[model samples]
Target: MSLLASGSLLAQGSESKEKEMEAAWQAAQSSAQAGPATVKLGEQATLKLPAKEVFIPQPAAGKLMHAMGNLDDERLLGLVLPTGDDDWMVVAKYEPSGYIRDDEAKDWNVDDLFKSLKEGTEAANEEREKRGISGLEIVGWVERPHYEAASHRLVWSMSAREKGQPADAPQSVNYNTYALGREGYVSLNLITARDQVDANKPVVRTLLSNLDFTEGKAYADFNASTDKVAEYGLAALIGGVAAKKLGLLAILAAFFAKFAKVIALAVAGIGYSATKWFRRKPSGSAEPK
Candidate 1:
């Protein structure tokens, strides 16, 4: 009877997992957009989200939560780039609600935002702890926020280290960039380890500049009388708004997957010894080389 019960439980677990994969696959296909073409950014502009380089433009955002297996609330995301090469992926979405004012960019303070982000990370760690996972800490920024008035572009990056990770241990970064439009903006995030950011930076910047904002939808087209302006400005966009966590962390889970081994040791409550046990031998180990 005990054996039968165990078998039944296993069957249920398998069925549940199968359903999840099917659901993820279907969702991914539903929102998937092929590249080398123009995709309207909610009436504000056109995005030439290319799919070459193993990049799949506008992939199903659900796959990032399910198939990728880590997240913090990515419901706002409308598009994703699943780069088959390495564990890197890019997420982009357009918020067309209104225009984001950049006047505050002139005196933006990094020290304040850094402090706010650390506090925000501490709060996020609480949730991680409840899930029997190791927590995280906001060490510092890999790149402080910078805004270019000419192009109406903003760029910044932050680094996070696992709780108890050695001081010299490697960290991950979310290199974020944004292009402001008359209606809203398009944020493109390159989720990767700190070491990989330099290599990936150029490509992502190119991607940002190539995104075409249609005429009358460009930042210069803002009509003060008729256009709605965002309640907050650039400073609020970079730092937390109202002391709440920056929505950026939601997608930072993409970095967690990139460093899966570190995540196993850091977040999953797993130790190094378990790795050896799970390691598989080469299929031809018994044969002569």
Candidate 2:
């Protein structure tokens, strides 16, 4: 989600705005695919969605993202939300920017990555404030960037708080994971309250593992002679490089300044409907929630 005018919600009138949100949520919930299902991520990959979660496909997912202040991005595949109250949501995106080289991960410096993240976020804050959203500052990494060469996967976590908020104030965390593919990569970013990340880590990791590229789309299947290479390397996904290329918020999407309140609305509107959706399923259905 990019930076949106914080007042955008209020401008629509509280009651009217909420009705729109509820309507969008309802539309999305009605289309959700109950899990223990196979969901194609465009043409690049597929996710083996577990029984404890639900997959909301595009159009509906895109609508929900818009209702929440994000622009309609074609890169968005869908949304992964838990079957129960997990207090987190995953935004899945696929960037077909060609093959990305992971060689930089070997010698990348952690301190430098941290420094670049702080600087990039500080710069992004100026834009956030201009749009009426609270300025955010990185509190430092909750979990440093870790890359798995064999699996071609990357994982990292960071916490942020609204500028001027007290040190003890509740913060938000963006726990990101990427799975590389021949065509490009797929990212699954989990947005949640900072305090809940540790408890929620397993859930996101499971989903990441469940996602697999199709036969010819696997990273190792890249054809050097014919394939295009991404301009940036793996490390770029972390800091300045990504901020410059993809925009900081595009990479982070950490719009959790008011996540608790936003999630409450999500649970009330989407989660409750999802529960009822499962109940509506026939007992003889092949996929049970």
Candidate 3:
């Protein structure tokens, strides 16, 4: 063939290949958007799985499955499985916040909490051994950090539980604790009844897994700021009343302080209303009120 003819043929082949590749890509994308099918594990129970690779089991009969995702940290997922018998299973995926500093009392307290949890596990194991129970095991302790914004505090929780307990039997529980700035603080003996412990794990795990620690910063800051505002509001209210009673500048200051938030809120509302009104077109005909 001539060189020009050969070049033209090659170009046509390349264009055909590109078209095929584009078609294949589009097909794959469509399939991905279709999502996974729902599967029934037991009577009246169903599980929804994503079209992606993960293949989680469908829930069994009489079990309710709950799932929540972190708003900021999309990677975190929490699942709660509540069995009708009051038994629960919780699964969480996310690192707890904060670290245990050596100088902090909270650090030492957390250590003691873990020690107590271990003791509880050992005791439960001993009891199981004495009873010659098979398949009974202490699954060790799990700890995570929980933050309380109201107090600007962080709690390190260490939980211990016995696994493979009979469905009807009580579960063994032991826990350790630590606070953000406190040390060597041992918590009181808090025990979970066997049945209750079994029932709570699923819920707790689900809650943890679904938590979005990344998005929590805004909420934490909002809470702290709001507390200060509330304090000021209360003071302003009191001062306003007192000033009115005493005939002092308290009334002016009180009025400004007491209504600051309300006034700001009203202004914001009015601005929003005006914007909406401006964007709307007038109706052609007036309707009767």
Runs in model 2 lying further than 4 Å from the true structure: 1-12, 242-261, 264-289
- Residues 149-245, candidate 3, lDDT per residue (tens digit)? 3433333323222355555543344222222211111111112334354444443333222222222232233343232222121111112222333
Task: Report how far residue 173 has shifted in candidate 2, in Å.
Answer: 0.8
Measured against the true structure, the TM-scores of the candidates, in listed sequence, are 0.69, 0.84, 0.21
Q: Over the full model, what C-alpha lDDT does candidate 2 score relative to the true structure?
A: 0.76
Candidate 3: segments with Cα more than 4 A from true spot: 1-106, 118-220, 225-289
Compute the lDDT of residue 247 as modeled in candidate 1. Answer: 59
CA RMSD, predictions in order:
8.2, 5.9, 29.1
Sort order, lDDT high to low = 2, 1, 3
Instruction: Write model 2 residue lDDT over 1-289, tens digit each, in one string.
Output: 3346656654456656556666666666677888889999999999998887888888888877776655678888998877675667888889897899999899989888888777777676766667667778889898999999999999998888778899998777888899999989999988777878999888889999999999999999999999999977897778666776666554543333323334445433343333343334443344432
Cα lDDT, model 1, residue 274: 17
Best by lDDT: 2
Candidate 1 lDDT over 1-289, as tens digits, reads: 7999999987786666545544543454445565655666555566666664222233345453443345433323544443334445566666664898898788767888778667666665666666555677776877889999999999988887778999897776777888898988877777766787788787578778877788888899999999999766776556554235335553323333333332233222223221221132333332111
Task: Give the runs in model 1 whose Cα sits over 4 Å from its true position.
Answer: 1-35, 54-59, 70-86, 127-134, 241-289
**lDDT at position 256, candidate 1:** 32
